[model samples]
Target: MSAPWLADAVVLAHLAFILFVMFGGLLVLRWPRLAWLHLPAAAWGVAVEWTGWICPLTPLENALRERAGQQAYGGDFVQHYIMPLIYPDGLTRHTQLVLGALVLLLNVTVYAALWRRRGGRRG
Candidate 1:
């Protein structure tokens, strides 16, 4: 495939991953086995936001864009793509922290519901 195509694919994959990280707990509610995969992804997502670490995918996407003779962007994927839609002012450190907390809160709430559904028993 062409470099531009590859770059587009990476962007789509990154977006899908972000969605999964944000809401994968709901999937886990249906398929408990998926938690094994999702828990780590969710943690990594939270870590990326909290620690201000750029996800590896960001650099990969940038490299692909560069290879495609396109202008590569600065900052993480969320800053480059998502923040513009949600926060026109742009993404700040405080906003990242709040996003991390929100993700954690949403996941915890989902898992808590799952636990209650399972009778509060541990496996």
Candidate 2:
């Protein structure tokens, strides 16, 4: 695929992953085994936000954009794309930490409920 095409694909894939990281808990409600996948993804998402660490995909996407003669965004995926829509003011370190905490809290709440539903048995 052309660099531009591939870059666009990366953006879409990155967005999908972000959505999954944020809301994958609902999936776990249906298939408890999904926790194995959702938990780690949630962790990574939180880590990225709290640490302000650039996910590997960021560089790959940036490189593709550069090759395609597009400007590369500086922040992580959510800050660059999704933040503008949800947090028009933009993402800050404080906001990032909150994002991380939300990920943990949300997942914990969801898992706790799931556990209760399953009678504390691993599914």
Candidate 3:
């Protein structure tokens, strides 16, 4: 594969992972039985960001890009793609923490709402 092709694949995979991290709970909400699967994935996603850990996917993408002679990015995939759109300046520790917290808070709120709905039906 060419360098550009590898870069594009990495970009797509990164985007998909982000979507899964951010909204996997929405899938769980739709299929309540999958809560077990989604919860862990959501937790892993939050933990990865909070700990400043590079997701396995990021490295895999970088490796593929390198094989194709593309220049791999230094930071996380989010910093390469999403940050520029959201922040004109750059990513900071505070912004990273806030993003991680927001992901946790959103999932928590979604689960709470689902629990309340389930409880209402029992009553």
Best candidate (score: lDDT)? 1
Candidate 3: lDDT over CA atoms?
0.82
The C-alpha lDDT values of all candidates are 0.95, 0.91, 0.82
Model 3: per-residue Cα lDDT at residue 10: 71
Ranking by lDDT, best first?
1, 2, 3
Ranking of models by TM-score: 1, 2, 3
Per-residue lDDT of 31 in model 1: 93
Q: How does residue 30 of candidate 2 score in lDDT? A: 96
Report the lDDT tens digits of candidate 2 across residue range 1-123: 899999999989998888889899989999999999999999999999999998899899999999999999898888889789989999999999999999889888999999899889766
Q: Which regions of candidate 2 are displaced past 4 Å?
A: 121-123
Which runs of model 3 end up more than 4 angstroms from their true locations?
A: 1-7, 120-123
lDDT of 1 at 10: 93
Select the stronger candidate by lDDT from 1 and 2: 1
In model 3, the worst 10-residue window by lDDT is 114-123
Better of 1 and 2 by TM-score: 1
Per residue, candidate 1 scores C-alpha lDDT tens digits across 21-105 of 9999999999988999999999999999999999999999899989989999999999999999999999999999999999999
The reply for model 1, stretches above 4 Å from the true place, is: none
